[model samples]
Target: MKTLLKNGLMLDEQSKKLVKRDILIDGEIIAKIASEIEDEEAMQIEVAEKLITPGFIDLHVHLREPGFEQKETIETGTYAAARGGFTTVACMPNTRPPIDSVPIVEEILEKAEEAGYARVLPIGAITVRQLGQELTDMEALKKAGVVAVSDDGVGVQSSKMMKEAMRKAYALGLPVVAHCEDNSLAKGGCVHDGEFAKRYGLQGIPSEAESIHVARDILLAEDIGVHYHVCHISSEQSVRLVREAKARGQKVTAEVTPHHLLLCDEDIPEPNPMFKMNPPLRSKKDREALIQGLKDGTIDVIATDHAPHTLLEKQQGMERAPFGIVGLETAFPLLYTNLVRTGELTLAELIEKMTRKPAELFGLPYGVLAEGKVADMTVIDLESERPIDPSAFKSKGRNTPFAGTYVYGWPVMTFYKGVKTWDQADIFVTFEE
Candidate 1:
């Protein structure tokens, strides 16, 4: 099958400019790209006022499949991803059985293939059952098609265990994506240890809980020369550590979430569980630092830590409810409106972080918009505006804090592997006249 995408504005990475071009897709690969291409026999899509680019990639996400299917299934998760303009995502292994074994990884892959929306890559748990005790056969996990290993929801507390995991992962050529938190310092706290927590008399999770572990993992990775990636970075000190680590040429990379860049503990408004997360929304100062880190090249990627839970689970209230918010559907609009339109980041810069940087860090080949590359792309309408609504989300998780906020730049369509996976704008038709 052949389809022509006509008159779309695309970023030419080598030239560092946006150029208008026509893209031709033959089967599952981008066949050609030129200033203009006409094929009457092929179906065509007019993207006159839209921006076409490589599909966005999320390095951290939780599909909640293989165990927490009630929260989110692979089908629902990938549907949400495609609607959110992502073509590929790596899911965290915090499911019921946990993705620590080869069988679980295979199960996820099979489910994703059956779902057939965005490409789903499984991240295996670093520890067996994520118990932080025994390692989960790193060699076997790699062979089972896991791109990386991480115990995302909980931190691996044992220093010796983490060091050994890093060593083994390095030997097997996989990145150690760490959820940095010193459990002892964390103390079962739910909200950031800041003004809100103090005002409400709630137990606060200190910044040290996350930073201490960030420091430890960076040190461990430095000694072993393993590629270490920090997940959901929310603290100022952690950003400083990552900045210094990069300065010293350590193989370390970090990602910031849209919520962290946009919200702080002070913005919680109430004691709602929707506002809570693992690393927790931090102080205003930490939020500012996270933005600055993205501006100055300290943060490499912008990922949606799109964890989903049932409405019942979220309605359980702050103290007892789960720590997460669904983000896949709102990430781009929130960031584009607040960051790009506000002059904090250019459109090209934002797209690069969401697309190219994550792919390069993870060594995947799905984020470039060049000829002969896989035809994974997203077409976005930057001129239209809409309000954030979780009820309309494709995922089962309707737990988001951006419910009534107005935003611009919604994705109009998404293509994965040359197939139209999701479409919001009625813009495709057979070529005529």
Candidate 2:
């Protein structure tokens, strides 16, 4: 099957102007990109006014399959990803039966393949069962196609254990994605340790709890010569540490979530569990620092950290509920509307972070639109304005705090490997061989 996207504003980093061109997708590859193509035999898609860019790739997401199915499964989570214009997502291993071993990793890959939605890359747990006590079989897991390793829900408490894991990861040429948090310091805390927590009389998690581990991990990475990536950074001090580490020429990269970029402690009206997340929302100063870091290239990517939870769980008080909010469905729209549209970032820069940066960091083959490149792409309606409706989400979880917020720039069509996976108007379209 051949599909021609005609007369669209292509957002290619190499292109000077938002070129008014056509893209011909053949089978699972972009067959041609040119100023004009007269393909009367192919199915024509008129996207003259829309923006066509490489499919988005998220480095961090929680598809609660093989464990917490009630919250989300591989099929539903990836479907949500498709609706949000992401073509690939790397899922964390903090599941019911954590993806720690080769068999578990294989199981996730098999299930994702069967689902046939967005491509799902399973991240193996750095430690057995993510207990942070013993390292998993890095060689076996890598052989089974695990893209990376991480103890995502919590930080590896023992520096000795972390060093061992880093050594194994380095030997295998795999990056260890770190969720930096000091458990001892974060104990019994539900929100940021600042004025909000004091006013609400709630236990707080201090910034040092996250930055301390970040500092330690950077030192370890420097010593072992391993690639280390930080997940969902939320503190000003942590940003400073990462900046210094980069200046010192350490193999370190970090991602900041949209929540951290758009929201702060002051934005939370009350102890809403929807706002409760790990490395909880920080101060205005911290938020500003995160934005600056992103602008200056100190922060490498903007991942969703798309954690999902049940309504019953989120209905509990902030201190009692679980940490996370649905992000795969809101990330692009929020970033497009809040950052790019507001001039905080250029469209080219935003696309670079969402596509090329992550693909280059992880050594993935997708995230670009060119001849011989995989046909994973997104067609966005830059002028569309819609309120965030959790009911419209494909994921089972609906714990987002941005429920009724209206935002511009929504994804209208998403394609994975030349197959249309989602269309807001026509959800039943199928790709034929």
Tens digits of lDDT, candidate 1, 83-127: 899999999999989999999999999999998998999999999
lDDT per residue (tens digit) for residues 1-433 in model 2: 9999989888655664577879999999999999898787789988878888889999999998888998999999999999999999999999988998877788888888988889999899999999988889989999999999999998999999999999999999999999999989999999999999999999999999999999999999999999999999999999999999899998899999999999999999988999999989999999999999999999999899999899999998998999999999889889889999999998888888998899998999988888889999999888978888887788888999899998987888898999988786843232111
TM-score of each: 0.97, 0.97
Residue pairs in collision within model 1 = none
Span of 10 residues, lowest total lDDT, candidate 2 = 424-433
Name the TM-score of candidate 2: 0.97
Best candidate per lDDT, number? Answer: 1
| Backbone clashes in model 1 | 0
- List all candidate RMSDs to the true structure: 3.3, 2.9
